[model samples]
Target: MAYTFEILETEKIELVIPLVYKLNNGKIDKAVLMERFSDMITYNNYECAVIYDGSKLIGVTGLWFCTRHYSGKSVEPDHVFIDENYRGKGLGKQFFEWIYNYVKDKGCEAVELNTYVSNAASHKFYFNEDFKILGFHFLKKLKK
Candidate 1:
């Protein structure tokens, strides 16, 4: 199967919003997605890409560049996802490898991402890709 990755655009927001909602377990709404997409495009913080199998969009990934004090450098890779039906097809690795090369080329010192503790399959994938777990990330949801 031939797969291609393309940077996201405003015209593609409708297609990408659903994919992002599915990937995020529907925690985000359309307005939120629109706002974030707009910010990503405007500030150039978003490196959103869609994986296409022929004419179908089967996966999505977003990378944001940021500087980390611990890493003492700029890092990329904020999120990645593949449609449930398209998992285990090596697309995840290909996505990461592409992001790795792309970020490195852009002078990013590292690429990082987080997977939930319950996501064993993702942990395995990251391990296979030679990503070492640096530490645990904890979060507290605040009332809006």
Candidate 2:
């Protein structure tokens, strides 16, 4: 029942890569992801927040701190995933509460996140957490 949350550093990101892949349906190559994540950590101003049950990792998400004219300081969390075995047990609620407090401590005025439209369960869960639908997240994947 005891859990911990920590802001992950670059050297430890591999610990959460498995859970991160879960968000993308396990389609990403581990080697490639590790390389890209390392680059992101090194250059893209992103950090990962990891959830641990005792010493074992149970969930992970990416956090990007930003400022906007309307929102001021905010933290945007992405790629959130809880271990399949740990879902639907109020852990997500605890995680978000922790994230809110974490962001506030960093002088953030808001927390924002995006979830895939087809993920209805997440939509309901987020709504239950008092999150409002702001707008659609449009993406255009450029050819590599």
Candidate 3:
């Protein structure tokens, strides 16, 4: 299958919102996700990398480019989700390769992400990709 990779414009974030909804297992409200996406695009400087198999979206992931004291300019990938039917087909490795090259061209020194602790499958995949656990990702939800 021919695949296309694109950096989805901030204004076009809604294109990937449904895919992200699947990432969250449909637990969060779409309205809430929309609001979060608005904030992410407007204030958080979020970018989304998407893969399409001839106009049908197969994978989506959020990217944040920033300067971190420890890593200089880095790309933090978040909420990475490939369609259920598309897993185990090497699409993810291809997607990451695309993202790595894309960010490297942008002068990114590293890639970081926070995966849910309970996502054993993600842990395995990231480990296979050579990602290491540097520290815990603690969170305190102030409001919901």
Candidate 4:
């Protein structure tokens, strides 16, 4: 199978939102996500990379570039997902390799990502890719 990877253009982002929702377990409404994601792409330093097999979109990951005291220039890839029908075929590995090269090209000092704690398979995969458990990630939501 021929695979192609490209940075998705702003106008073409909707094509991957379904997979994004799937990654979030469909908890967030699409309209809300669309609006927020559009705003993010418009106002933030974020970009998405998509992998396609021929004409089919097979995977997507959102990359956010930032500078931290520990890592200097870093790229935190979020919303990583591979189509259900396309998983376990080594595509995720290929996608991450693409991400590493992409980050390196951007002169990033490191690449970091957070996966849900309950996702053991992803934990194993990430470990195999040499990602370590740096520390705990905490969050607190404020009421509007």
lDDT of 1 by residue, 35-125 (tens): 8776776665566777888888887777777778877445555556788888878889887777777777878887678887877998999
Error of 4 at 19 (Å): 0.2
Query: lDDT of all predictions, in order shown?
Result: 0.76, 0.88, 0.89, 0.89
Output the TM-score of candidate 4.
0.95
Question: Among all windows of ten consecutive residues in candidate 1, which has the lowest summed lDDT?
Answer: 71-80
Measured on C-alpha atoms, candidate 4 has an lDDT of: 0.89
**Collision count for each candidate, in order:** 0, 0, 0, 0
Q: Against the hidden reference, what TM-scores do the models get?
A: 0.84, 0.93, 0.94, 0.95
Would you list the clashing residue pairs of candidate 2? none
Clashing pairs in 3: none
Question: Residue 66 error for model 3, in Å?
Answer: 1.1
How far is 128's C-alpha from truth in model 1 (Å)? 1.0
lDDT of 3 by residue, 23-64 (tens): 888999888999998888885657889999898887899898
RMSD of 3: 1.4
Candidate 4 residue 118 Cα shift, in angstroms, is 1.4
Angstrom error of the Cα, residue 9, model 4: value is 0.5
Comparing 3 and 4 by TM-score, which wins? 4
Candidate 4 off by > 4 Å: none
